[model samples]
Target: FVNGKSLTSTSGSTASQSTFFAPRSKTPNRQAIALISDHGDPAAEIGKEEAGGQNVYVRQVGEALSKLGWQVDMFTRKAKADDPTIVQHNPHCRTIRLSAGPEEFVPRDRLFEYMPQFVEEFHKYQAKHHYPLIHTNYWMSAWVGLEVQKTHNVQLINTYHSLGAVKYQAVPHRPAIAETRLAVEKAILENAHCTVATSPQEADMLRSLVSDLGHIEVIPCGTDISRFYAIPKVDARLQLGLKPTDEVIVYVGRFDPRKGIETLVRAAQLIKRNTVDASNLRLVIVGGSDPTKPDGQERQRIEQLVGELGLAEHTTFAGRVGHDRLPLYYTAADVCVIPSHYEPFGLVAIEAMACGTPVVASDVGGLKFSVVPEETGLLVPPQDETAFAAAIERILSDELWARKLRKRASERVQQNFSWTGVAAQLSDLYRRMLAQSIMGDMILPSQSAISVSLNPDALPNPSR
Candidate 1:
């Protein structure tokens, strides 16, 4: 049984896990909501070519919402044949992968053709178990949500993890589906009940670049404080097989050219040439890639560049560290660098800060919002090797100042960017949207209704 409904068919060749078996009487009493991330699978391993901040955001938000008495179902396209169709993260949250295209990995640019099948599967699921509200992630999923809204009595909320208008300005070559993505992105922003922008910068971009007609809210991305909190630097370094006295700088993200890994590599070279005692300097790049894929090919190029610069001895390609082990790399580092040309929300910056590590990130998009210059960490111009080297060297040279930055960085994340706090804000937004849908008005409910409606032991009674 799943969500108070009987499983009608389960004869697939792939192994199925009966993990969503909450008894009807004891199940969550709050309203069920669907989180649609079409290309980014919330359950997929982080650091994979396609998996990054957007994937982390959807998965973390779903699990966090489930803790607040929400029945969260995250839907994504089934990418691999051997992968399970359903993965239960908790009693209240699960990932449901639907069959789309050939059940193989397809780059997001080419995944639009398979969206009709995804929408059909979603409709089938909705027929059995209704989702009153659906929050869509990325432009592809936003299109699916818009299509679903046409046939179903559902409220749609969208978050464009990356905007095409903003992204296209950065890259030299544009994908063939760029026009379609832009159109869908615009329509979703204008037509959806609300569009959630992860940063104020992103919200502003939506109005100027996408559409000026949508209700936008700024809800920054959050990190798991419990998992990412400060581990002793000595212990973290020892575990990672790094010397305690080494001046370590870490880069954690995908291997995409737009991520500016090459810039970071060049910045490292500059540091080595300038620093008087560069022998103890270490650079650790953490992310996963498929050798046959674009990210893998990019990694090969970076490795070749590292060799050309004669920095291989100082650099360790710690490729694709798992989420469970990522905190160690962050904690062990003197400073973490996010050199992305654009980031809708820089999750790595906050994660590192949560581990009491300072950040030196590009001053663009969400990085500008997450990293407070000279307070938590410094922000340098995007793709500027000299600026990055100077900022990194400043932090590494001044241990006293770096310690102060680390303390404040951890404090800032705990006080402001905790997942539990972010979920509460999301819970309020969901309630307001649901209340509006019920009343057919712009007015929201009283404080009493919000408190009582979300109570775990009581069923949601909007009328009350």
Candidate 2:
């Protein structure tokens, strides 16, 4: 069953095999579409370096779209030699890893040079299995989509997972490829059929920093409600071996400086020093990292800071928690903290909230939209250790208020951030775009033919 609904055969045949395992011919007619995530492999393990929200977003969207009768083909660059070329998530959805530069992991900043080869590989695939509509993720994939559109009649839709214009503002230094990235991001916005912004703040950023000419839509990143939901605190704590009195604060994401891990660490220091009976306070940092990689180095720095701040005894680095086990951590926590310098959308915040845990996130980007300040959770200024400490302390100090926040948080997510709901919105948008393309084609024979058909009434309401 998908989202509490079962699939039934119209013929009412009592077949030996389940309908789920039926051949492609027996399946319903499905629209073929491509989702290109050049650097974010949809099938990659989460919490790893460069494998965070974008990876989860693509994979979840693909599977959810498949349930709505879309044959989803997710494309990504092959970063590892031993990894499979294709990973089938379901009968209708699969991830296609294409070879570009080398069969080794390369940082996103350096991956731009390899996009030409990625585009060529995409062309070869398009020749064999044509996709009339393609949605591209990130600036690199946007470039590929634009290039493919030059040769094919494919309708292009782009999602800027992280815009360089917004990201570069937070960093101390710019990368060598910053100019190229900025240019590509702007070009995609002005050229693609539409650009999807995960938050209204992101859409505003595109208008102010990127370009105002693009058709922008606000569709949020979603979480699997089936996977993440309220679990009894006692049960979750018992499963994770946590003390009943412990005031647990959990941070789940990549170990990057931009993610503001240091701020959370410092906030823990403040919580310990200022609060009475804070001896039972515990900080659980959950994410994957390699010692040699950038994120690993950041982890090392954070660990050293935790030691210097005398938080070593109170802190636990729970390496990498898988999705199956992640909900337990969220449910067990007293409060979840997301101290990112910037987030287009904070997937961790909603995931934790869905598990009936209050969140203390930075008041930046999409966190503003997801976490309803006093109603669901608290939002503090980004990188402000004092503010983060105060916010987290509020949740831990007042059990009744926290409980209220928990219930409202879960309800908010169920009403707005379910993967099934998100996919339905995207399906509507895709159908409308396809219809507009067909309409444009049908009118091409007229003397007063319009090059494009963009009826405002046909567009999905951003307010939804």
> TM-scores across all candidates?
0.90, 0.90
Candidate 2 regions exceeding 4 Å error are: 1-27, 441-464
Q: Give the 10-residue window scoring lowest on summed lDDT in candidate 1.
A: 453-462
Q: Each candidate's lDDT (Cα)?
A: 0.85, 0.86
Stretch of 10 with least lDDT, candidate 2: 442-451
Q: For model 1, what is the alpha-carbon lDDT of residue 56?
A: 93
The count of residue-pair clashes in candidate 2 stands at 0
lDDT of 2: 0.86
Per-residue C-alpha lDDT of model 2 across residues 115-153, encoded as one tens digit per residue:
888988988878766676899999999988877876676
> At residue 417, what lDDT does model 2 achieve?
98
Q: Candidate 1: what lDDT? A: 0.85
CA RMSD, predictions in order = 8.9, 8.4
How many angstroms is residue 373 displaced in model 1 relative to the true structure, after the best TM-score fit?
0.2
Put down candidate 1 lDDT per residue, 1-464, tens digits, no spaces. Answer: 22334333232211111212223567435567899999899999999799998889999999999988888999999999999999999988999999989899998888888888898899888776678789999988988887776666576788889989999987688898887888777777777787789899999888899876667778889999989999899999999999998999999999999999999999999999997878998999999999999999999999999999999999999999987999999999999999999998889999999999999999999998989999899999999999999999999999999999999999999998998999888888887776555445444423222221112222111122
